[model samples]
Target: MDRVLSADEIRWIHDFLELKDITYYDVQVEIVDHLASLIEAKWAAGSRQSFEVLFFEVFKDFGDHQWRQLLGAKQKGVWRQVVRNGVSIFLNFFTWPLVAYTFLSFLLIYTFLLAVPNAVNYLQESMYLWGFIVLVTWGYVIYRRPAKRAFLAYDGFVTFLGIDLYLVGWILPDFFAIFSERFSATPNGMLGLAAFYSLLVLVILTFSILMRIKGVQQFYKTYPQLLITQ
Candidate 1:
């Protein structure tokens, strides 16, 4: 018969992970299950091993990076999933009222561009403000929210937010400007296109954060013990 791990024993193992710097909730859940199963097996075999001894032994098998590698793995997984979800959302915009809305909005903007010389400037400012707002909001969420759960999703958002800020505020604009100048593209046209894409990128990033929030909600539903009041 396998030995059942006590609550205290399980908590002790969880603390050991924190000591190893594996603070992310998802990683904690994985390593805790792993340690419990292995420890139970060893206990059933009649080996008198201390939990601490077994715990360090398990961590030792993971090499020098320790449990920090777990964070990297979780971050990579979340990043890919967020990107896939964002692409799906973009593709879905081709359907229904979304398509109609997109077309009408572009038409309205184009008409305004013809009438208003300053329209491009306003659009560019809006794009910069969009990126800046999201970056700051996310930064504040991470700062003010006491980290009681996995930071993989939060860190993942911050990582892409940095890229979005750079792309919107500088890189993409410069790239498009270069191409526009080479081909003698209209300044307004290039500015409009750049702003449109920058806004699109921000929308995708916002949706990705929404998905992450939904995942966290589901996690709490599944493991009520892990739920922390927001």
Candidate 2:
């Protein structure tokens, strides 16, 4: 003889749906209640069936496939909202400052390089050392926080940009050296070159520190749960 679902069985279904995490709470509750009603109606029809059989039959009509469709719809709605909000946020908070900083920093670096051709060689070597340090530090930080995977990935990209800055600082001097040796007199000789490269090293170090601070701040904002441990 088929058994009717007990109160415990109904509660089990509700808990199972919750643990699955596929559907929203309200939707999962609705789905579970709907299934329970359908199963109750089946039992009321005088059918000889096990709870397992009734569960399977009802679930087949409202299981993974239906859940997948529901989840997809939910995700699409969330993404649409995200895009709408993201556009306004980027315009107000991020876009212009980022553009202005990038342009001005680039302009200053270029002007410095053109103005002091002789210091290029030492600056290049200093930059290479800084690049190695940044790479190693970034790798360590990312490995230490594997759980915050998305933020780690973003951090890694920023770390790479830091390395790029170091590389450019390193290469600019060497390029100037080759040009001076091949084409014309170097502008600032050995002592001046040392000072120039030292300045480059200082700038790179400062930039790296600033980037690390920003990355930490962003990581905290992105994964506020991480702050609990701190």
Candidate 3:
């Protein structure tokens, strides 16, 4: 007499495929149902065959090589979707807020620097020195942990901050003119100070850009199949 498979047995097979990672969850369920129906039809012939024997026969006909190819294709599709979703969610959560915060930070720092009459004063000079140190430290951190999510957030923060500093430095002349008029400094001195500030901004921007580019390249190299595996 024909042997029959219970619904629970079908579910078990599906779970097995999932646990083995032989197929994705959705595909595993579908494949299990289809195979079970095929087995049922075969067993309805009234031949006394065991479930294991019937299953392997049906499975072998699926063509091991072809099934592997199909699984590989499905894995690629799933991984791409995973990576795309992760990046989309990350950008949604952090992009705009980071940009706004970085812009405000740049404005506050530049305002303080402009307000200080003596740039050479210990406090003023220390601020500039610490700012430079922070930028370099961020660049190094990104370089070391290129593939981490934290690194991506840090890079975005630094890039926007650098752009803000660059813009403020470019417009320093207008602010310098007002300050010089009140303080009685020559335009030459104001121009010299602005040039130095612009140069520092440029250096920071360049370093940030270079570090970001290199870090991205390294991330891809380290996880070449990260997108496909996700």
- Largest TM-score belongs to which candidate? 1
| Candidate 3 lDDT by residue in tens digits, 114-171 | 6656642433244355456545655665565534222222233334345434433344
Question: How would you order the candidates by lDDT, starting with the best?
Answer: 1, 2, 3
lDDT agreement with native, every candidate: 0.60, 0.55, 0.52
lDDT digits (tens) for residues 1-230 of candidate 2? 55567878877776776666643433454466788888888988886787778888888877677876766665565445444443444354336765565455555554565666543444455556666666666675566453512332234324534553454556655654664355344434443443434344444454555555455544455546533522
What would the per-residue lDDT of candidate 1 be over residues 1-230, giving only the tens digit for each residue?
55678888888877777777777766687778987887777788887887778766765776647556667878788788657755665677557776666556666666665567655556545656666765675565556433566555545544445555565667655754454345324756654664464345444445545544544443444445544521
What is the lDDT for 136 in model 2? Answer: 64
Q: Which stretches of candidate 3 lie over 4 Å from their true place?
A: 1-4, 11-28, 44-48, 90-98, 105-230
RMSD of each candidate?
4.8, 10.4, 13.4
Model 2 deviation from the true structure expressed as Cα RMSD, one decimal place: 10.4
Q: After superposition, how far is residue 161 of candidate 3 from its true place, in Å?
A: 27
List runs of model 1 lying over 4 Å from the truth.
1-3, 57-72, 132-146, 157-161, 172-225, 228-230
Stretches off by above 4 angstroms in model 2 are 1-124, 152-176, 179-201, 226-230
